[model samples]
Target chain A: MDDLNLLRDLGRALDREPPATLVRQRSRLAQARPRRRRPGPLVIAAAALATAALVLVPALLRQSGKAPATHRPGTVKAVNLLLVGADGVRGDARADSIVLVHLPADRRRVTVVSLPRDVEAPAACPGATTGGRLSGTIPNRSLTCVTRNVEALTHVRVDHVAILAYAGLVEMVDAVGGVEVMLPRAVDDPASGLKLSAGRHLVRGRPALAYARARHGLGDGSDLDRVKRQQALMAALAKAAREKITNPVTLARLVNAVTSGMVADRALTPAFLKELATSLERTDPATARYKIAPVVPDPRDPARLVLDEKRAEALFRTLR
Target chain B: MTAPPAVPETASDADLIRRSHDDPEAFAALFDRYAPMLYRYVARRLGPDPAEDLVGDTFLAAFGRRDRYDLDRADARPWLFGIVTKLVARHHRDEAARYRALRRTPAGAVHDDPADAVAAAVTAAAVRPRLAGALEALPRRDRDVLLLVAWADLNYAETAEALGIPVGTVRSRLNRARRKVRAALGDTDPTREEA
Candidate 1:
């Protein structure tokens, strides 16, 4: 390999080995033949400290991205796009997945909000096709059902929204690598082709998607329960992406894999995608906080849950 | 002179050095592996020119103290690093000045990439003026931890050992340093946002 390009890049700083100075010093020390002394408390403490240090130090470094290189900062204010995806048989492109992310310029902090797909919400400005007469009416559906509705009503200015169908989700999950989800309860959904035991399973691609999608065998058999599971999986995906998206080759692969079958608003052009990708380069998962919108289990309808607006507002206030 | 047989049982770097006190070559191999990392750490803190001298001084000091060295550990990297940290401590003025300089220059201005010349210059123009004062305001210990971790890539444990503190202490110091840096840098995300 041509060493220059590899050596000069920021990653090289991570991989560089020390030079000859140490070797020369070591030899000098070896020849001097220092006398060995009996074990003492100081020596013992030093040894203990070293042992304690060895195990703890490496793991902490692993928490952040490998190492930051000298790259120019992005030339704009922090931009956040709340990505949401949902399943809607009869709606004007409701985003089923919700990811509220704040991208800062320094690459220091990223805040993400993952919305439950089954959250019941009112539509802000219902489009003509949703079969609604009320221009600003609440829909009798999950939060995922009213994502675009909420965005429009609130004038939250969603930069982009993407919707992925079940099969597409499976393919995307498979492409980047599988996602890990912990089953709080046993789940067996014949229709979704999911049969998971109550343990930690590394489900990739299609099976993993099924696991994320399965609600029949989970908590209270509610879609909100499944949404919680989906959020957990996304946290894992973000971490994996932090490590995986380091190289340009892998980055291109990811962009191709995700963008090809993905659906987004027309404003999410190629230039916007580049800007977003560049913006996200430094969002390590270690520092980011993840939370779901607060919702109370409906007392009227036991199977459904309603958004706890008061607590949710408090949480959103902190985010703002 | 011929060296002793390589014994699997005599396993630490310190042990190897102890056993091979008669063989200078074996000891040299261990030194070679760690010197540059220490040098870079010191240089980043102290600057390139004097860093060379301090690095040389650190190794020489290590050589003088090797007789007192315990051979239990196979790697001398951490021990050598500790010595360099102490050496840097003796020249606190230079270290402080370096941080001050770093704060003045925009992070982009430090780029080694030729292609980024224009962008870096523009970035430096935008952010460099405000950063220096903010950096100057940070407590010395906090600045030390931030620079070492960000520039030197010392893991928290290694930083602790080098700084002669507990691991928890290192983490807290780092957190404080980062908070100050973020605040000074205007709470902007460096990767995607412009200054």
Candidate 2:
């Protein structure tokens, strides 16, 4: 026999049948939440509020013959909005990305702080005394848990909360006709099936999402690297929305897309969203600051991160 | 709302994967279809201990990534195998060690059906150690190409898809690997009857 056939024989000799059933694995699959879910009605209401802020605010101001105001004195001084990018079904969802959007009183500077999903934080769920992963608290108490834990961690009151499914993020990007991202080097992440050559490329909805989600074959292959990429993607999306959202048709499509994919708290009324959008209108994407919360490897567990207490305190103090 | 159509036993992998987007349970069918073959292939590379978990992980990863799956591709073997192959690549040390051990240990008696016992015995006793040594010595990428074809029974196109490489690259790697194996066998010609 040829060498190939001989090698085949060797392979055969090594083969053994697996157990009849992978009970543990099957249970893991059944329990595990699948990603890319359609948003429910609550999300649509939230999306409408967000969309109203983006699309309707300008038209409303135009019709009222009032110039868009940068800030309304005697109103809310600052807003700390917690935006959670969740994966899987509504109630069982887990936070894949946690971003704190800190819009100061001036509304000129938009500072976004990305908290690593694996960051150690006090569990907001009852019956849990010990601290757990920041991402884990979401499924237990919904966004309320995440908001409380983040408030405790950052010492900034979360004024509003918006939960976005990955599907919604994709639709929002596509609605804006995609965003441009600069890749430092070529990426071929087989896990996410994201392939792109080094350079600046305008990626559509799916590729844009892939660029953000890819971690294994990009940068240092750490969650920190992914955080940086997500920040860039967010900045790019902001820039795209600012530049490309011009015509009413595009605006309507964007509204439809965003509303279908996101849910916001009842406190985030349409009027509040409108004011938030107006304040952020002049906020230059270039001036927008993006930061990852200061973190150090947990002394007890290298895999998890504990906030750099001193630096984190200093950072959160600035936002407050 | 109307209920989803019943999943036929003969449903193509692509159909099941597309359905899995709406019904996560549909993914279990994919796991059942591919896990055994994946287990066997992974076991051949890294032994049986880690095989089960790796196969499970492959399915889980695929489940999470069902959105990105190309529905146009009818068969998911390449995609599924590709996922398992990437997982296996992480255990390169274990795979290399397994081959080194195989090279050192002598092949024992041929426990097989009576019909092919003579050919199996000749091939097993004489050629296994050399083949294992060649496999260990070959470059990682080349070995991946060679083994996917010889062991996993994937065609060139499927192997190319699995490794995320061009079909031409697959051909070249397979040729290079075969040449090394030939060199390792030297003039022994295990296929020839012994004097």
Q: Could you say which candidate leads in TM-score?
A: 2
Please name the candidate that would achieve the greatest DockQ relative to the true structure. 2
List the candidate 1 regions with Cα displacement exceeding 4 Å: A1-75, A87-95, A104-107, A124-148, A152-157, A242-253, A297-305, B1-195
lDDT of 1 by residue, A58-176 (tens): 22234444552334754655554555453432223345455565555564566566655444445534432333211112232223334455453233445444444334455455655
True contacts kept of 1: 0.10
lDDT of each: 0.52, 0.77
Angstrom error of the Cα, residue A315, model 2: value is 1.5
Q: lDDT of model 1 at residue B78? A: 61
Q: Give TM per candidate.
A: 0.40, 0.57
**Model 2's DockQ?**
0.24
Q: What is candidate 2's lDDT per residue for A238-296, written digit by digit as tens?
A: 66775666666767777777777777887877676666767655455557789999999
